[model samples]
Target: MNIQNFSVASLLAVITLSGSPLFAKEQTQAPAYEYGMPLDIAQAVRIDEPKSTVCEVGQATMTYVDTHGQIRHVTFLQQTDACAIQ
Candidate 1:
């Protein structure tokens, strides 16, 4: 058995296994051209029913169904309420 080679490999394995934040700095940096935005805030709300339509108010788009099961889409100037459905 090669004792020297076994010891050297064990030392390297220990160093690599210890967590180091500095080693991950390069991975955390965002690219130059790519920008970040709040994806949850920008998502469009869809209400499914029998009748609905699609409408575009601004950047956001909403889709829903009317009383008669007609699909409709509408955009809002401002988001009045946002609550997750249970």
Candidate 2:
């Protein structure tokens, strides 16, 4: 009986792990950034913003890799265009 129970438990574990998202073929998108949200960034990948001659408020995007090695991007408002000249 004990051997049979062990076998059942092992089988269940295998099934659960197989169906888990960790083993999933599809990758889900990361959550959008918010105020005071902590980000575990491993490395930056890219940045998207408008090009202008003067400072302006525009939509900006920052692409980076999280600590889990997953690629993610955050979109927010930022000052784009050329740098301020002294």
lDDT of 1 by residue, 1-86 (tens): 69999999999988887746556753453222224522223333473222213332223344645555554454334322321121
Q: How far off is residue 6 in model 1, in Å?
A: 1.0
Report clashes for each candidate as comma-separated counts. 18, 0
lDDT per residue for candidate 2 within 1-86, as digits (tens), equals: 99999999999999898899765534554355689988878999998886777867777778899999997777777776566551
How big is the positional error of residue 28 in model 2, measured in Å on the Cα after superposition?
A: 11
RMSD of each: 16.0, 8.2
* C-alpha TM-score for every candidate: 0.24, 0.54
| Candidate 2 accuracy as lDDT | 0.78
Top candidate by lDDT:
2
